[model samples]
Target: MKRKIRVLVAKPGLDGHDRGAKVVARSLRDAGFEVIYTGIRQTPAMIAEAALQEDVDVVGLSVLSGAHMALVPKVKEALVAQGMDDVLVLVGGIIPNEDVPALNAIGVKGIFGPGTATQEIVDFIHKELAEPAA
Candidate 1:
């Protein structure tokens, strides 16, 4: 049997808000993906370490502190340092539209803003991870 997709959902930087993160974690779990939720106030290093230890297929970051430009890349760097460059990275919450392209350029596979459907996230993960890497 194929292994279930493992996802690490984290709140990076000083984002004390966690309702969205929790909701996404629960949604992913209900959709049959294994999810690990690292709570708020997590540093990028802490998140990367959790992803490595959990062997996650994806790292879902919830950043609402207006620090995406700074925090996301650091998280990506940490992941790469852990040799997790192949892992899918996703971001959600409070990201400006202008910054989306840059985030994508750095390997964030998807960015979901407020009011995005949970099912869309589930489907995105399914489709992205289902495809063979190019």
Candidate 2:
């Protein structure tokens, strides 16, 4: 049997808002993915540690504090430091359109903004993880 995909949903930085994160975590859980949700005010290192401990296949970050540019890179760095470079990283929040390319350049495979369908997020994860790595 195929192992279920494990995802670590995190709220990094000072973003106290977590309703969206909870929703995504719940949606992913309902979609048959194993999910771990780190609550609000988590640091990048903390998130990376959680991902490592959970042995997650993906790390989904929810940042609405306008700190994506700064925080995301740090999170990526932490993940890499922990030898989790192959793990899929995703971002969702009030991200600006102009920053999408930059985020992608830094290896964030998926970025979902407000109003994005939960099914789309679920499908993206399924497709991305289903494909063999290059």
Candidate 3:
């Protein structure tokens, strides 16, 4: 049997709207991935800490505050500090295209912007996880 991929869906910064995050979480759950959502108003530190505790295979960060450039690095750094360098980090929500490179450099390899299909996200995760480095 294939072990279900464990994923942590986190909302960072002051983004009060979590409808998108909730929908993503449910979609991932429906796709057979175990998902843990950190809810709204979570700091980068809290997100990383929860990721570590959950020992999740992936950390899907939903940031809409335009603070993604600032917060994403913090979460990645925290994960690295905890020796979780191998964990996959995915960013979803409103992100400027230019910021994708920076997030990519910080180990947030997957980026899903607005209007992306839920199945695409699921397929992307599966394909990425199958990669040698993931």
TM-score, per-candidate, Cα-based: 0.96, 0.96, 0.94
Looking at model 3, the pairs that clash are none
Question: Can you write out model 3's per-residue Cα lDDT over 27-127, one digit (the tens) per residue?
Answer: 99999999998898888789889998998999999988899998889988889989999999998999999988878877788999999999999999999
RMSD of each predicted structure: 1.7, 1.7, 2.0
Candidate 1 residue-pair clash tally: 0
Per-residue lDDT tens digits for candidate 2, residues 6-122, read: 999999999699999999999999999999988999999999999999999999999999999999999999999989999999999999999999999999999999999999999
TM-score of candidate 2 against the unseen true structure: 0.96
Give residue 92's error in model 3 in angstroms: 0.7
Give all candidates' CA lDDT scores. Answer: 0.95, 0.95, 0.90
Q: Once superposed on the true structure, which residue ranges of model 2 sit more than 4 Å away at CA?
A: 131-134
- What is the clash count for each candidate, in the order shown? 0, 0, 0
Q: Give candidate 1's whole-model lDDT.
A: 0.95
